[model samples]
Target: MRTVAIIGRPNVGKSTLFNRLVGQKLALVDDRPGVTRDRREGEAELGHLSFRIIDTAGLEEAEPGSLSDRMRRQTEAAIDEADLVLFLVDARAGILPADETFAELVRRSGKPVVLLANKAEGRGGMAGAYDAFSLGLGDPVPLSAEHGEGMGDLLEAIEPFLETGEDEDDEDRAGKPLRVAIVGRPNAGKSTLVNRMIGAERLLTGPEAGITRDTISVDWRWRDHPIRLFDTAGLRKRARVEDKLEKLSVADALRAIRFAEVVVVLLDATIPFEKQDLSIVDLIESEGRAIVIGLNKWDLVADRPGLLKELRADAERLLPQVRGAPVVPLSGLAGEGIDRLMGSVVQAAEVWSRRVPTAKLNDWLAAALSAHPPPAVSGRRIKIRYMTQVKARPPHFALFGNQLDALPRAYTRYLVNGLRETFELPGVPIRLSLRSGKNPFEGKKKTWD
Candidate 1:
């Protein structure tokens, strides 16, 4: 994999871009500059290419031998070691003298550079993007790292620099083991369910809350397909977690959810849909992982008539974000409903990875828009010109149109629901990104197809 270092001045959204590419919040981010003091690295994927991405501390001139100076040295070392450099500049802030100085440093390294004009989501940053030509590092790629815009353009820009030929490992990705994480609240029988799944005492289980204080993984085969199971410590309310170790464990559980392709949210059948349970499901949805709600300890529940149907209805009403997710009733200790749960998991994974053809997507978009035309905003009708699935580990789509920033949230939800139903993408989080017209000053009118 090619190594690409993100080199820029302070607060240019390098860490945000890094986290976006890595598909995990591995780096800490804040409004304040200089939040990062060391070089952080992670594997990143863009379209079909995968590479190693390095997030370096903000490049700032400081006193010799000072902390800031050492950080700068580390960044310079990263630039020297990287096969290419992603030079980011705050498009909203425009080009700064510091940016000029840093460009010279990266230019002197003689490495391939992709100038990123970050924060160029709307028209506000376009002027700066045009001014970036003065930096003499080729044309700037307008990007919005926080909103995940311009990623398609970035992928095209860097594809030639990175290796794209598939290797033996890449060939195995289709047959690779599916990763599934079991997460829930404390005393929710997470460990019990994990032990029952693998049919072995691989994890410590008990009635005590917080018995498992770490995220543990187990490898097993189910019905001939390889599977990796991640059993995470039960997550409790943030207010209830005061211990430092518990905090670390919770963070680890969160990371496991982000890494997993499918997440089985194990809920106690006796007390289902607690605030923490809903919050955990929300986290899984936000992370764009396929979801399966496991109603554990079902054998202990007294009510058995129509309770499963009621619970499924409640899941739809309470968690519409992951609407139609499979809800399995099982007793982990008794090993009941394990097959059904695994079946749901495998199906959810397939749906999460599903992709729709652009022709079909646009056909659906036209019908949906015609059925319920977008409401006029400020007396002008919002025209949705095009729609296409950009990538699908969670089925993210891009919608191009005029006045898209003014598109109402309710309307977007309607379109998301339509896509879900029309394409049969149930239970998986569907990402719909809106891309508005370019800066009007470019002497070109926005065209619709």
Candidate 2:
């Protein structure tokens, strides 16, 4: 991965800027100087640009054996490893002696740099931003990372230093790894499952609840496909999450789920489908994510004939929103049935990202309308004119028709269900929206041929 390092002196809002760029608060931020002591790295994006970003400790002049000296060493190490450096300055503070010193150091390294004048949001910092010209590190990208101003200029400045008009990972690769998050209530074997899949005890796991206070990610190849897996903290009722740290952890987990292409709602097979579990699944579906249900701790189950079948039925009856979502039973500790769980995950992702061609979609719609024509309202039947998929990654469609405002909800459900069955889009939510364009000859042409 191409590396972009954010470098500056202490308390110049480097950590805050890093969090803003990454779109997540992965690094701790404080008003105090030297709050960040270690090098933190995350995937970052600036408009169309995506790269690995490193956040380094602040640079300072310190005694040879002092902690400040060690922090300076870490900053130097980050600069050495960086392909591009974002030399950040506090525009409100103007050009200081330390800014000039760091500018000289960056100049000596001969690395490409995008000078950022942070905290230059309003007229307050304009003069200092102009003063940055004396540092001789190229024209500064004057902006505030806090309020996110001047990002367009920043992206323009950094574009020339990036990987030539392509994302770092998307240059001619056949398929991108499926980003999946496995989330559940606390003590649902989330960490244990991650440890088993990686074939190592990388994550701390035990019988204790709430051991994982953050969302941790790992990459692995499974069944000839790349999988980027995120193991998240178990979510509980918001009323129960009084602790500040747990609240942060929960927020972090929610961010993971939003970024994920697919999500596995891991459930304790022993106590499956608690109220919280259903709510979590509701949240995933509401986010328009592909979902798979894993029945963890299956080894302890005293299996009865038709028990698994009945359980799947319950999933349908309970989760009518994601009515046909896959529910796979597995033991994360024993590594049993993992292949099945992965298979379901892959299948769900495929379905989630599946797009039907416009021609095929119209054909399916015609057939569906023929099979079940719209019911008459009073004396007139609603006219359905055109149907096409406007987006994928959850498969949203727009239907241009007349009298849609008066159409019943049951009829809309019929169309949605018909699309699901006709396209074989099982385990994926189908969105069908009704639109009216006021075509002059609306009912004359009932279908798109």
Candidate 3:
């Protein structure tokens, strides 16, 4: 598929156009300049044409090795990879020196450029749109990305460059990439593990614990299988997270976990099973995300045998919620056991997406009921009429029965464990919802009051 990159100086609505093209707010947009420091991408469609669109950071002139300079380099990389460039400018702000500088750079690249005069909703921006001809890119396509106007002309401008053949990305058509979120408490080497897994320094890592602030996603292929990985900020205790920015970062990380198909909780080998680490696992289980535990920094362990045994015991005793989750020892730094970790991820994903046939489910339900029937509530036998899977992906089941709300938590755990064992589900959270069945004799009159 062809790629289009949105580029311009700060606060020119570059991200707005990118989001409009993608039909979703994949990029974070704020009135503040430089809210977007990293490039994000999404597949977009325009009329009968489709392409992969990139949202790059606002261009800025900075000295080499500076943060601003780093952002510029990322934008340049995006431009280099793009088949076309959507150069956006705020029509209301008119032309600036910075815009001219970046326009020169875009012209130098010699890629097909569509100069977009965004914020041209009214006559307020008409003069700037007219002045855009001075940039020497082309006739500016006066557009209002915020109000969703002038899309037809914009589409016509770029449609000529698109290849008319069908999209050749087979992986996208066959199935969606597995969405995995690598999460843990601060400094568990989550970013490093991602870098090692992709065999590239795609993420910025340092000795700092909370370097990653946003939930950044990247497309990667592992063993020819496409994987979309979200690298998130390290979560600290809520009380310890005092800064407002850190709070927002934590919130973003939680969103990633909620949307992820599988979550790998990276644990520091020396401090495996810390209170925070346990809490992170508990959160993943509660969210019903398929989970795998990667004990990172295995190279640092002095007594591997003793520590591994202790860790296994702790997982059994403490993480009963996900009883049989895979706990693979690995060193994210040394890349040891990374392959095993990926295998565990694949296995967990299969279990997470498992769907049980209704016939087999009822059969297992009967056997489970016969083995250990639900105890009576208030001396009345709680009759469970039937059970059926409601959905998969950390499978959810709905059990119809009498007085289900009064059923003991222990009984629910029994059914969950039975379902897990009988269905061969491991390392994935199971949800069993109790729903009261309607009484058949409800409409009948009560003769004796």
lDDT of 2 by residue, 26-93 (tens): 99998899999999999998644698999988888889979999889999999999999999999999
What would the TM-score be for candidate 1 when compared with the true structure?
Answer: 0.71
Off by over 4 Å in 3: 1-172, 440-449
Query: What value does the lDDT take at residue 404 in candidate 3?
Result: 82
On lDDT, who's better, 2 or 3?
A: 3
Q: Kindly list the per-residue Cα lDDT of model 3 for residues 294-318, writing each as its tens digit.
A: 9999999946568887888899899
Alpha carbon deviation, residue 275, candidate 2 (Å): 1.1
Best by TM-score: 1
Superposing every Cα of model 1 onto the true structure, what RMSD results? 8.0
TM-scores of all predicted structures: 0.71, 0.63, 0.63
Residue 390, model 3: Cα distance from true site in angstroms: 1.1
- Cα lDDT over the full model 3: 0.86
Model 1 poorest 10 in a row by lDDT: 164-173
TM-score attained by model 3: 0.63
